[model samples]
Target: MNIFAAIADPVRRSLLEQLAREGPTRVVDLTRGRGISRPAVSRHLRVLGDAGLVRAIDHGRERHFELVTDALAEVSNWTATLTAKSASAPQPPVAGHHLDALGLEVRRTVRERGTQPGTRHTAASSTATGEIA
Candidate 1:
């Protein structure tokens, strides 16, 4: 099972959280007060074990399960790379910002050329005035 798929279930995630919080724990302790049967929790734990997200150790007659955080490095790296790319990505222009910038540029160009509103230098006027150059 894929690590992501193993942790996708709410029950499995809860079990991992419990293991991480309480360190190594027994199956009976894990099922206590959770309203889930020991067999069901064991099945979930088996999935987690297959995904390398958790490990089980036997001490005498009891089995202890503990979280294996190293298994999540792939997920962590993937998310971190996505976050970095998004942080460096160019943001989309805000509404009306492009128009506002265009308006300012037009105003600046008109001011520089000393052109008046509703008046423009046409090809005919430039040719007649010999100002084509």
Candidate 2:
């Protein structure tokens, strides 16, 4: 299964989140807040491990699992590129015109609301005996 599909399950997502927050932990510790049995949690961890979402290390007799941040970064970059491409595409005139108009309105509002002349307060001026209040 793809990484997205493997992580779609709420249980798997929770496991990943826990690993992210608590760092490496044994399967038993990981399953403490979960309602599922330890074996079920282990199965979810196996799927995550296969998807490169989690990595396991031997700690004495037990295996500690931790999130593979690099793998998630890969996923993030892929989605970011896809979104950038979609956002940069030239849309139909109606949509493009709407966005252009929105941009202009925002700029106009900012310009209108900007600091007016003589509105600035300066500490040196306030202390100067000859300066206007």
Candidate 3:
């Protein structure tokens, strides 16, 4: 299961939060007071385990599962990368009255010159109220 997809389920996310807050715990400890069934909790844990979101340790007859934060860190790192890239990206020219006026001038120039068919460039003319032709 995808890590993000696994975390999408509230129960699985709650399990992760519980593991984070309470530290490593056994299956019984995880499900003892919860309304969810033991088998359901086990299934959730399996999905988390597949996603590397949790790690399990077997001690005697009990299986203890703990949050493996490294997987979450990977997600964090991916978001950070996207954030950094966006921050460094160039901003587009802001559209305002100035741009609207410039667009009018361009349209008028195109109307005066007219457009040539089969040319690489084609221009559309619009009125001040923005009716297009």
Candidate 4:
């Protein structure tokens, strides 16, 4: 199952949140303060581990469960890309000067595209006056 489907259950989400806050913990530790039984908690942990959301590591006789941060980082980067695309779409200018500023910014960005391969460009850096469009 996908990460979203695996975490759709409230119990599973709680387990993840707990692991995020409390660090790696044993099954007994996870279910101690929770309202569910140990077996139910184990089942949820199994699903999370399978989905790569939570990782289990052997600690002595018990297994400690912890959040898999890399999975969350991938999700965050995907969301950020979608948010930036929607936010940057063209819209009607609020004033006459706004359209001119937007045009200049776009032109400057195009001009800077052939510079060094590793060079970084911000919205302000692309503008002649160092102001964001």
Candidate 5:
């Protein structure tokens, strides 16, 4: 199961929050105030374990479940990469106003002039000037 999918459920997310806040806890303790049966909690835990989000430890007569943060690092790294890419990418110029539209049109014409067939370029045309053609 995907880690995101495992955490997609409210119950599973709540269970993970509990495990993180309280540390390793048994199914009976995790079920407290959750309004869900022990079996349902166990099922959710099983999915969490399968997703590598949590691990179950055998202690004495009970199995204690705890958050496995290493797996969560994958999610954190992916989100960080997305944020970094968005931060570095160039943003479009702010919209509205005829000057902005004119500026865009000027840039578009300049760029397309090179690619368009039969578009003659001279020394005067290549030189940068305040006036737009």
Candidate 6:
């Protein structure tokens, strides 16, 4: 399953949070007061392991699980990519100096909206201003 899908489960996510906070922990230690059986925790761990969110180490008889930092980085990177794309939408630049003017207008609109300037621009405003070069 994908990282998102694996993390969609409250139990699995909780397990991950606990691992992150507590460091490499045993399955038995993870199950304490969770209102779930050891087998159930084991199952969730298995799913997390499959998704590469957790790494399991066999220490003699007991297995210890720890959070895989890189897996969380993937989620962070994916969100950052989407934010970058949406914040600067790929509309083709208007021809010539009009592009600069349009950029200024975009900044103005963003400032008016109380958001970071130039994050968004409107076609109607440019058209009305006869600046659609």
lDDT of each: 0.92, 0.85, 0.86, 0.85, 0.88, 0.88
Residue 113 C-alpha lDDT in model 1: 61
**Scored by Cα lDDT, where does model 6 land?**
0.88
- In the range 1-133, model 5's lDDT, one tens digit per residue, is 9998999999999999999999999999999998989999999999999999999999999899999989999789989999999999986576458677888887788686754534666656656533355
Residue 35 of model 4, lDDT score: 88
14 in model 3: Cα distance from truth in Å?
0.8
Better of 3 and 5 by TM-score: 5
Among the numbered candidates, top lDDT falls to 1
Q: Per-residue alpha-carbon lDDT of model 2 for 26-87, expressed as tens digits?
A: 99998797888999998999899898999899988999999998878767988999999999
Instruction: For each candidate, give its TM-score against the true structure.
Output: 0.69, 0.63, 0.61, 0.62, 0.67, 0.63
Ranking by TM-score: 1, 5, 2, 6, 4, 3
lDDT comparing candidate 3 with the true structure:
0.86
Superior by TM-score: candidate 2 or candidate 4: 2
Number of the predicted model whose TM-score against the real structure is largest: 1
Worst 10 residues of 5 by lDDT: 124-133
Off by over 4 Å in 2: 91-133
Residue clash pairs of candidate 3: none
Whole-structure CA lDDT of model 1: 0.92
> Candidate 5 — number of clashing residue pairs?
0
Tell me the deviation in Å of residue 32 in model 1.
1.3
TM-score of 4: 0.62
| lDDT of model 1 at position 68 | 94
For residues 1-133, write the lDDT of model 3, one tens digit per residue.
7888989999999999999999999988899878989999999999999999999998898889999998998789889999999999987688588889988887777677564433334234445335554
lDDT of 4 by residue, 71-113 (tens): 7776688789999999998976587798889888877776767
